[model samples]
Target: MNQVLTQKPHDMLAATLSNEMAAVNTLIQTRMASEHAPRIPEVTAHLVEAGGKRLRPMLTLATARLCGYSGDNHVKLAATVEFIHTATLLHDDVVDESGQRRGRPTANLLWDNKSSVLVGDYLFARSFQLMVETGSLRVLDILANASATIAEGEVLQMTAASDLATDEAIYLQVVRGKTAALFSAATQAGGVIAGAPETQVDALFAYGDALGVAFQIADDLLDYQGDSTATGKNVGDDFRERKLTLPVIKAVAQATAEERAFWMRTIEKGRQDEGDLNHALALMDKYDTLSATRRDAMEWVTKAQDALTALPNDPIRQMLHDLADYVVARLA
Candidate 1:
């Protein structure tokens, strides 16, 4: 059997789009500064300087280039996408009550939730200001809707997180709102900014939506199986948090009465023992939900790749396709 080598899609994207990415980073630094409040810059810089793949902004830059855009607004738009993403992370860490992010102390932990929340609001405001500079109502609409959708997804997850009744459809809805909304908006706005044809623009949206779904599913799956060092997350973190991610949802769907009782005790009641994580993994293994979840992630990846078929046959398009595959390949 041939062992498949895992490819680094974001590295390829960064290498190819280095110039535009540099412009985006510069703009990010410029906009994140606040003269009225030094603390705002401090909080923003802490998270921004932390090494993230900048995948969302790269998607904006790459899609704009793929559509043959030669204008300057794409850089601003790319920065806008990144600010929104970073802001979301700030808010998410606060909500998750997490101590670590990107293997560093979370901003909320270092400073306070108030700082993280206010700074996140500031970033969101800056993102809106930057998007408005594009002078495209369509771009504003798409990004605004995505921001709202992301908030709604977070709220939905709040209600659904520990509920055993949460189904796969509800899970996908949450994924689409929280993760895929920004991705689809990123690509869609890029195409719109470039004045690409409607078909190509829609194709870009589809590709992004599918790619985001695949990415989130892979991340959720990794919470159970990934190396803590490599993933910057402890295994079974979601289980411990009672997030009701896909694998656990699958396992819950097929859970026997006794297994369901265990889930109810641990997840619904907020009581967990040291052995609970191992037992959850054992149940998942018994049900083979991990493999089933991996299959679902691959299906989304294929959907993402298929959506790229409508795009131009170019290196950018090929990179996008490979990116979709590499999302799931992290699981392998």
Candidate 2:
């Protein structure tokens, strides 16, 4: 068998789109520079140059190309998508008080919270400028709504964190807002910029939404049972953070009266002790919530694959389909 054939779907997609991705990187570097405020570039470079997968922006580039876009505007949109993502990451690190990102000290940790916030604001302004340059009202509208939705989702997650009442429906809402909104916007804007038909645009939106949901759910699942090395965090990190992810939600929903008190003490009140993580995992195992969460992630994967049926039968499309499968392949 060819070695390339055995590579992961995203790695393959990255290789296939290497030239375009290089262009996106160049554009990102160009736009992230600062003429007046050197700290803007310094803060931005700390996070942007970090070795992230760049999966979100790549979605924009791949979707535009899959829709037969041959214009340079897609490049701008790809950079816009990345700027928005990085800005959110900077803000998120502040909110989460995270010390590390991509296995390095977070920008907020290296600099200060003030610099991260201001630099993130600068990036958001830059993203809007890039989108406006495209001169497409619909593209602007899509990205603008996504930006608002991202903020709203973060607020929702903050308010809902550790609340026992936070169920699967609320979880889905948060996921759509924080993760899927940008994803759908990235793909939908790509199709719109390419002047793809309405049906194809809708399909692209659906594909991105489902893929984002699947990706997030898989990430949540991995937080419980994944390898510390591969996942870049110790297992049960979510439990420690008091996050009511799907598995914990499922377990909470099925908790006995005694189990409810346990959740109330540890999750709602944040009085976790040394054995709390083990107890939480035991509860999830007792209710088989991990398997249930995996099932939910797989359903989104199926929805994503179904949505791709409406797209063009290009090689990029096949990679996208495989990408959906790869998101949850770890859980398998």
Candidate 3:
């Protein structure tokens, strides 16, 4: 057989869905515009065009196409997913007090927090309008539930932040809420719009859920070990912020009493000093938590790929499987 090399899996997926994605971008631009409040578009545009991978929307389009859908509503749903994702990001940057996003200053930093918040709210309302235009109440329900879950997850993370008692189970719950909920919703809405069989829809949901968890786990791991230019944030941002992500959580689980006190002083009490991040990294290295976290991420990747077996045997299915592996491949 002739072998053909390709770009990254997401780039290949984007090439496959270029036409639909173009439509989604057009719709996003059109919907993000506000006649009276020009700042809405200004702030929204800053973040929306920040070169995000648009992976969530692509999931919607790919799943719909995989199920043999032949309608324009898929485009609408794809745009809807993007809007929801963008809205949450705007809110997140403000809440996290983040200074950077997508390798640029965050909207909250460039513009005011007020602008980011109101624009995010505007995009959210616009997202509802787009989904309603699809004429599928079920699609509306899935995205709506996802929006709620995202908010709940952010709230949960706020409460769990810097708390040494936070465990793996709580970490997973927060991950599912903040990250996986929208992923599953995007895929599930696409399948539902295509009128796919219950089994296939379930599989799509499972695949998205697992992929999202894996994606988040990889991101958390990167915080301690990744290049700043590639990750778009300084290494140890999570540690400096006192956010107890999975790698730290794993290390905490195996901490000796003295080690536990270190975590408590830095994370729980928020009294971090110079060289504290290095000390924390050394402790995680001592427990080998980074490798353990990578293993957990790989397990989720397997689950995501396994879910694809229930879907049709199409090229898109293969791309979806590759995408799952690519997410974890970042760790390498």
Per-residue lDDT tens digits of candidate 2, residues 1-332? Answer: 13324778888889988998999999999999998899998888888777689998889989999999999899899999999999999999999898877778899989999998999999999999999999999999999899888999999999997899999999999999879999999999989999999999999999999999999999999999998778777788888888899999999899999999999999999999999899999999999999999999999999999999999999999999999988888676
How many clashes in candidate 3?
Answer: 0
After superposition, the stretches of candidate 1 with alpha carbons farther than 4 Å from their true spots are 1-7
TM-score of 1: 0.98
**Model 2 misplaced regions, further than 4 Å:** 1-5
Query: Candidate 1 local accuracy as lDDT?
Result: 0.92
Clashes of each: 0, 0, 0
lDDT of 3 at 203: 98
Q: Report the C-alpha displacement of residue 273, candidate 1, in angstroms.
A: 1.0
Q: Would you estimate the TM-scores of all the predictions?
A: 0.98, 0.97, 0.98
Report lDDT per candidate.
Answer: 0.92, 0.91, 0.92
Count backbone clashes in candidate 2. Answer: 0
| Per-residue lDDT of 281 in model 3 | 93
lDDT of 1 by residue, 126-208 (tens): 99999999999999999988988999999999899999999999999999988999999999888999999999999999999
